[model samples]
Target: MEEDIQISFLNKLSCFFLIVLFLGCDTPGKILIKNETQDDVIYRYYKKETDENVAIDTVSIHVPALSEKYIILGFGSLWTESQLKSYIQNLQKIELIKATDTIVLKDKVEIYNYFKKRIKGVHKDEIEIIIK
Candidate 1:
């Protein structure tokens, strides 16, 4: 009878530990998306990678009722137009470059997830990639 009781206690302890373990961890394949809704809100991140005070060209793309995309290209910062064009074209040809989503929370915890993209980053001449 004592042995059976001890076994039961051990099983209960094991189950409790397991419950605690699973509860304290984040499940894989789960990502958070945050939507920004406001006028004149700077939701995009642009890095010049240089200390030049040059004018940068930004392109914001929004499908009327569908999706949104933002691209910031700095003029005379580092990359030439041809280099940027080639890089953009190569990015478009990639197969797994899916949607880019951002998560914004209270207290300013923000992160960006590039979904379905096998390559996290690539190096190009005269330009540095920024992931936020």
Candidate 2:
């Protein structure tokens, strides 16, 4: 009986680890933004606010030069519109700023883009944005 219990415990532990490893591979829905510049760049991801109209939620994250940043959404493409978070289903935007200068540059930002027009009933698991 003792040996059987120990074996059962080991099997459960092994199954748990395998489940975690599989789930940790990547986000179901993710936006990959790449910074092709030679210097680091700061960017923002815009999501509409859920509770208030005309309100917004902005995520400011930076990527090392020649690297990429991933914006993981709460729900994946397989999720229906009703199942997705309100902010994520709305229009998604990204603002790219050139950060080579030292003066906390604000006005010199180069371009603005509409990352996703609108996440409709059907979407993709991955979207990639390349910024120059």
Candidate No. with top lDDT: 2
lDDT (tens digit, per residue) of candidate 1 on 16-121: 9999877544222121222233322223322232335654433223322222333334432223345433334322121111145443322211111132231222
Tens-digit lDDT string for candidate 2 (1-116): 99999999999999999999777653367667788989888776566555665777777888889999877766444333333334335435646677643222122121111334
| Model 2's TM-score against the true structure | 0.49
Model 2 alpha-carbon miss at residue 29, Å: 0.6
Candidates' TM-scores?
Answer: 0.23, 0.49
Clashing pairs in 2: none
lDDT for 99 in candidate 1 is: 42
In model 1, where is the ten-residue run with the lowest total lDDT?
A: 104-113
Q: What is the lDDT, from 0 to 100, of the residue 76 in candidate 1?
A: 28
